[model samples]
Target: MFTVLPAAGGYTMSENTKVIARIRRLMALGTRNSNPHEAARAVALAQRLMQRHGLTPDMLSLHDIQESVCQNLTSNAEKVPAWLSSLATVVCMATGCRCWFGWHIHTSCSGVKSVRRSLHFYGFSGRAEVALYIYTVLQRQLRADTDGQIAGYRKRRILKNTLRRRADQFREGWVSGVWQVLQSFAPSECENSMLQRWLAQRHTGDTLGNVNVRAAGKCRGDRAARVAGWLAGRDTEVHQGLTGAQAQQQITAGGCTHE
Candidate 1:
């Protein structure tokens, strides 16, 4: 999609700037695949690359980086997500992030590590919900598409090859369906009530998975405190069957407050 940006006076960004912006947008589109630490690492890597190329890398904050990234920077070369790369081009050139856009190239892989479910991985649940809804619609439509093809292949005596192809197609379809179904299915739609109760604290609403994680954490911590308090009682007197270590463990796990 074409966007109008503030008109610049004969200003053209260098290739490196274009490449860097593309990289940022590409990373942003893969929102579920990263967290803040990963974003930080990415930011560090990008900064270093700029430095190596003898350019000054702007020290960008997390919010700045996120905004810059979501803006969809791109170049004619399109080294990144070719689809959204154009968006990046307009954002970078038109409404600049005030980053010290330059031609330096710094390189290092020190900051990239996988942190599961960090904040950088945004909208996984929401996307998953939408994905599930889409998948259900697709599923009801798939067999019609493939069954028609299989019947044709059978009638043509496209026998042996067609049979294998049919099998492959069915397997592929099944796998695709399962994935889409899973993606669209929220954790709240989970079978276990206890788990749902726990998750409801973190991801709430009309969706099955709404829950307050903070409340859950407090509950877990409080349980430990209560257990610790009970264990302290046992410390002075060992019960008939339980040993001191076991008593201590039981108490600690129960969530007793030390003080």
Candidate 2:
């Protein structure tokens, strides 16, 4: 029941309707599937549809859609690293979803204090779902990459303090590099402008915080390792390339059931 008013050269209302229906179905399939492959396929399909029609995630209006707002509580603030939080913000913004952090404070009987942190998402149901899915996948990939780097440093017999410092430096570089690459995936200016107008009319202030990561450090000959990590991060498969129309239609009809 969503209505997307046609902008010049944009998809027709009929096309928008079809796209929105397909997105909802895909989202539902993604949610039900425990395997992340299905979710990734759904995201790929949505990206293809948006690219084919020159549409952004926010272009399809959800005024009449009955999809409810959803929220996910992440790990405690103390456990979540700054780089991870920044990456989450970047993913939410790139996916056209709004996110904020919430802290839950508790005190033990022994007078020790602790805080649990959560990242809250608010937006159209389907987009919010997609944003969380993307964030989870990216976060895992980043951690794996960081672990690999740390293992390599350990193998090199570097001093303990130097190893820790270099690991931190590498992480900072990798996060910053990945963030820069992700920004390239943001919606086009025209689409963003349209989205701003729509949100303004609805009075939804979807603002994202800034992501700040330290510059990658280079210690003597270790610059190559940092550069390699940055390149690998940039090459992370966040979004798949466009598929043929037949493939896209098959995906849409099957609702991401295909492998």
Candidate 2 achieves a global lDDT of: 0.52
Tell me the tens digit of each residue's lDDT in model 1 across 118-149.
01011111222222222233334333443544
lDDT of 2 by residue, 1-259 (tens): 0112212232223235676668667766777778899888987786787788776644454332111222333334333445556676666556555555544456779999875555544343255556666676676777788788888777776776667556656555566667655542344454345444543444233333333333334564356566766776776765554112221222222111212
Q: What is the TM-score of each candidate against the true structure?
A: 0.19, 0.46
Global local distance difference test of model 1: 0.29
Q: How far is candidate 2 from the true structure (C-alpha RMSD, Å)?
A: 14.7
* Superposition error at 253 for model 1 (Å): 38
* Candidate 2, residue 209: how far the Cα is off, in Å: 11
Error of 1 at 50 (Å): 41
Candidate maximizing lDDT? 2
Instruction: Give RMSD (Å) of candidate 1 vs. truth.
Output: 25.2
Count of backbone clashes, every candidate in sequence: 36, 2
